[model samples]
Target: MGNGGAKFKFLSFSGKFRVLHLTWLAFFVSFLVWFNHAPLLLVIQEQLALNDQQVKTLLILNVALTIPARILVGMLVDSYGPRLIYSILLLITGGLCFFFSLATSFEALALARFLLGFAGAGFVIGIRMISEWFPARQLGLAEGIYKGLGNIGSAMAAVSLPVLALWFGGDDGWRYATGITGIIAIVYAGIYYIGVRDTPAGSTYFKPNKSGGLEVTSKLDFVLYLLINIPMYGALALLAWKVEQLELISFNVLLGIWAALVLLYLFQCRKIYSVNTDVFQGAVNRLQRYKFKQVMILSLAYAATFGSELAVVSMLPMFFKTTFAVPVALAGVLGACFAAVDMASCPSGGWISDRFGRKRSLAVLLAGAALGFALLSTITSEWPIAIAVAAMMGSSFFLGSAAGCVFAMVPLIRRSLTGQIAGIVGAYGNIGAVMFLTVFSFVETSTFFMVIGATIAVAAAAAMLLDEPADTMIEVLPDGTVQSVAMH
Candidate 1:
């Protein structure tokens, strides 16, 4: 890590940087394809002659599958490896894009968009991939670069898709714009599959000993795992409520969804039992006893950090427009500053965690984020627009940093289960989004900020329970001998 004297060359394609660039590009394209319809939503609305509620349904469906998809993909990536999973997902993304583009009815579009949430799972896969390639010392920085730079794809989609549509011209221009993203996915999936490796040659790619659910070390952890999973299902239930209220789906379907979520929750409990049943019989070794509460803590922290990011990013444009009484276009530009700052600030957060300490960095960042959001709550019509924008940017710095810093701790906990850990933590982000947005629907903009601000403060308090990562963690190599990796 002291190799700062030798500038870390990003252009080198030989080692970790190659994997970082390739994987981030994969994440980048996934986000772009996932959000491709967003920029073109207006055109689609006009073409399909859809009502406002239906358009909102499309937005809801865009993220509906992601919470569960990340969990499923995490298991698959840990089992099969990211190279295969990512390539497969990208190919499917291509097909979904094509399907959405050719939709002749709202059902087809909604179906395509819902299925396209699978693309969001790509982020989890690349997290596993990057963690596999980079050591803990460089992990935060590497992940920050991957995610922060990758997140730009959404902004790029916003900026470029509309222009692409205009350039293509005619009513079908949106279709072509959407289809081009699909084509990119199809082509890149091939390249990624052919080029990427699960791990550096001769290095064992560790897999969890049991496959169905995350392995927990103790009975209490088992209970903690089950308790934590409740919110994910609740998030799905909330989504069903939103869609049902819009009359996008029948009440019978909503009932069926609730039943299915209950069944899935029970099934997950069984899986948690099936995987960690030995914990009830025997004591786990201290070397192996990574805290399940760590996951719980990180989940809450992520819900505050990334969850708030998703909710706030979605709301910022409207919030700014309404509060400032500015042009919609100008508000959009201002809103975009949140994401624009992410490229630098996210890396800064990770760097701060790496240099200072993960627990301290996250705690400070979360507290800062809470304060930033609290300040945002104080913003009023009487306030100058520039002052308000500065407060928003200040929050973004903390929010972006907290997002990057969260993953900085993930790889060091346990190498084999990083994907699953990442998955659950990532799922909470979506859960947080659903929860925050659901509450936002019932409250004012200022109330929304206060709610998030309070939630983050609560998460920060919980974060105090997080123990710093130890000097080393043990992972079983493919040869069955445990290998020790440095944590700090």
Candidate 2:
């Protein structure tokens, strides 16, 4: 396989580029609907008369289910193919958005927002879709472009939703604006279904050998995979603890939730073992194995990068309003500056990974992200607001790029398992958000930024241990024929 290709023409909406455009737009709609309430959160709080604790709980609930949803969606996309799975996901997200927009009580709103977390899993679908359409040499840039443009949905909500609420000219204007996102999601679901195929003509879309859990090649990896799953459930437990702290749930209820989480973990371990029973029996071949360590390192990196992005973006508009005493609309625009840079920076990270090497690009970008967050931590109310915004945009550049770098390697790990691998990595991103947001609930804004910087710095060091992906991966056809897929 060659490491060169024709220059990408992103504007041309023909061939694979057409799939790229449509697929990314689907992801964009998912994010837009997922976060429509964020910039307008204060408005919702005022209209519904929510307390501070309830407001913070909304942020936690927004990302809590995404951890498990990504894992489940990953398995489904791998089994059914991205085309069908993504369409169904968007349709479901649209309904959830409508439900959220019509919420008449905090309980209803909380339930809607928690259900909306599934939309975040839409990202995993596109990772597999893009990997099918684009080759490895261009995979990084392609994935970067997909995620970069798609992620603009959150920034768009930040910048537009506030203005949109004002335009609608009523206390319920926020509802109208949010409902519009739902309509867009539903309309696009049909368009995405018709506009894209799972793979190009005459190409095969590979499926995992088994379903329910990610397959591991070795016994040690099986154990590591099980151990790695603990944090996901632990993150859920953390959320339950936070709810208990809010006094919404009793201590006894919290204990029950924790107990259920333990049982869930044990059940998942059983499914994982069933999926990779061959590993225990010593029947898996060497060439068929990929390192589970790659998944672990990428998961950690994503938790810091994308995870921080989720936590920060969710809270940033409010952060600016309170810290610098800016108006809501202006604060939203400033908060958007954090995610706006994704358009350029994400692709830049992917291009860097493509031109250089994946391991090197991720490590360097993560290091830069740590430094960026460190600079952000120094911001105080005394500082000029413009400087704070500059520091935030600078930090976002590194964070978004690091996210691009993380997904760039996900598909290359195992072609057939791309969706599940992307799911695990993507789930960790939410896990990071849950952990960081939980921290934010307890600490001051500066402390929150400082904690993220420290976590990301540690992930940067671990990135060095990542082994570069090999030139090819072997997969089995349904007919039992062995096919060697080229990575580059």
Q: How many clashes (backbone N, Cα, C below 3 Å) per candidate? A: 0, 0
Native-to-model Cα distance after best TM-score fit, residue 136 in candidate 1, in Å: 1.5
What TM-score would each prediction reach against the true structure? Answer: 0.97, 0.93
- Candidate 1's error at 31, in angstroms? 0.2
Worst 10 residues of 1 by lDDT: 1-10
Off by over 4 Å in 1: 1-7, 477-480
Task: State model 2's lDDT.
Answer: 0.90
Q: Could you report the Cα RMSD, in angstroms, for every candidate shown?
A: 1.8, 2.5
The residue-by-residue lDDT of candidate 1 on 317-393, one tens digit each, is 99988888999999999998887888888788888888888999998999999999999989999999999999999
Off by over 4 Å in 2: 1-5, 162-172, 314-332, 379-388, 444-447
lDDT against the true structure, per candidate, is: 0.89, 0.90
